[model samples]
Target: MPLRKADVVDEALRFIDSEGLDQLTMRKLGAALNVQGGALYRHFPNKEALLDAMADKIVEGIGDPLPDTAWFDQVRILGNRLRTALLSRRDGARVMAGTFSPGANTVIGTDKAVQVLSRAGLPPAQAGWVSFALFYYVLGHAIEEQAQLGLPPDHDWRERTGRLAVEVSPQYAAALDSLSGTDPAERFDYGLNVFVEGLRRLQEKERAAQEHAAR
Candidate 1:
């Protein structure tokens, strides 16, 4: 049977999982599929197209509906969900940050997030901007989290950096030491909460300024 496009995407993801993204090539994929390199071109015009498909596949499950909750909770849910999706596959976060088409899945996921922000009183443009900001923040955090996958769970990055800093200046070492026992997952949640809180504060400030201007 001839391979379908979805099959190609599935095999490509498997290839990426085992071989890593850096080693992905049309020729290699074709070899893995037992087809000529040109066969992939019929489905994807080029490597970038294949990468975009892979990225889309990585994030395809991000279109879940917003929960029945407060605006803050909605945003939190969306953010965490996106992070979870990106962390599902090997180097999935990097794939998401790379080439991708703004297809239905991407559009729906973004729309849900923007709707949450809009309900929180942000103007349409601001809500969209906030959604974009949150997406990038989650993507960057996931990338960092995945990059440390090979390290031991108890490894203290701050301690390693603190040692070098202490050799140069104790002040910097002390600062780094302050962050010494924080886990990456904890840090991710902390940063996300901070962002959500900041948005709340901004919404309040905007309303207050508008009231003041009206009076």
Candidate 2:
């Protein structure tokens, strides 16, 4: 049977989940899906094209912004949701990290993120810059988090903490110890709040400077 685009993307996602991104290739993917190598060529001209398709679909899973969601709500929800999706699969963040695709989902996701920032009163350039920064940070963190999710021994963090405990303040060590078993969701919320808060502060400072200069 001939494979459809959805089938191709689904197979690609599953292959990434099982084998990790480094090992994913058109030849290998074809074998995984029980199809000939050329089967992929019919849908995607080359390995690069195949990757583009996979990246597009992955970004596509980021749903449209809810009408009821405010700027903070929309941006927060989108950021966290995307991070989760990418981390859910093996090397998923790595696959989507530098992918440049013009697919529907990729474009729409960018539009929604930018729109949320614009609604908050930012001009086109600032909104675009910060929105991209937020998304990049989430992707970068998710990749690191997923990579460390399965440590053979949890003692690595302990050893590092011990080093910091010796040189850093006791309060720092205490804070680190306090989060030995911290909830991932809580950590995500805290970090996201920091990012958005920083953005708000920047906007406020810019507005204040403008007002002072006008006087």
Candidate 3:
């Protein structure tokens, strides 16, 4: 079979999954694809372009948002879907952390999010800004989650924190203890809810001000 652009991306993702993102190189991907390193440059000008494609592939896998849901639910669903996609492959979050793809899937997903917010009564500018804010929150959370996953199996954050907390003030220890039993998913949901609730309040306030001004 002949090599294609999609072929290169698929193999690159596979390479990242098995060997981690830091280990992926054009030469290695080319070797795996059984072609010369120069061959990939035909599809992607450089490794950064390949990473962007891989990030787009991750977004592409998120499919579509649910139908007829409340804007808040829709936002939550998008955040969860993004997180799930990022966690699907090893170092997946790391692969997407700083890369932005103007790829179709990425643009479509972003547009949908902005549309949802705009429909919920936010101005287009605010909606777009909120969309990017939500994206960064999810990406940042996923990056931290993936980094933790990379740690040794027995690594216990609380246990480690407890040891250091004792040396710090009691208030610091108490604050750290607040995170005691919650898993990453729970923490993610809590943060997402907080963000959505804030957006809801802002929308309501804006609507109220608009109504007042019209009187």
Candidate 4:
């Protein structure tokens, strides 16, 4: 049977979910699929290429582009949707964050997101930046969840990983605590609302400024 793009990504996702990102490799994926190890090379060209395709598929699921929703509504929905998609696959968030997609689905979703901001009266450039901001928020939340998902019952890794990092700021430590010690799905929703609410404030300020300037 010919290896379909969907089949290839599905196999890769299944492997990721079951084995974790640490164990995934092209050779491992092929063996899992019961195909000659070299056969994957024919379809994917390289591991990086396969990862890109996987990222694309994952990102494409960021929600079927919503053009008619309110600004906060669109951002909130995309944030939640993207987080769920990444959590669905092993290291999906990490891989997608490491890669950028100029592919069709990603671009279309991005364009539609900006369109919502534009309709809310932001200039084109600001809207574009906000679109990226929303994606970054989603990616950041998802990647953090991946790292802390399966804490040992004794919580050894939890204590170690939760220790304040040298690079992480003290001011952010409280926020960091919120990032762990809870269900990722709930945390994802919380962080997503923060970003959307922040955007809502900015949008209101912008609207007020625009109105004031006209007065």
Best by lDDT: 3
Query: Clashing residue pairs in candidate 1, if any?
Result: none
**lDDT rank, highest first?**
3, 1, 2, 4
Can you write out model 2's per-residue Cα lDDT over 44-127, one digit (the tens) per residue?
Answer: 988777777787777776766465856777888888878877767787787777577657877788787888889887998988
How high is the CA lDDT of each candidate model? 0.84, 0.78, 0.86, 0.77
**Candidate 2: residue 56 lDDT (0-100):** 75
| Per-residue lDDT value at 21 in model 2 | 82
> Which is better, 1 or 4, measured by lDDT?
1
lDDT of 4 by residue, 54-86 (tens): 788777755475656577887777777777777
Best by TM-score: 3
Better of 3 and 4 by lDDT: 3
Candidate 4, residue 185: the lDDT equals: 79
Tens digits of per-residue lDDT, candidate 1, 117-155, equal: 888888899999999999999999999888878568787
User: What's the lDDT for candidate 2?
Assistant: 0.78
lDDT of residue 93 for candidate 2: 80
- Report the poorest 10 consecutive residues by lDDT, candidate 1: 173-182
Could you tell me how far off, in angstroms, the CA of residue 83 lies in candidate 3 after the best superposition? 1.0
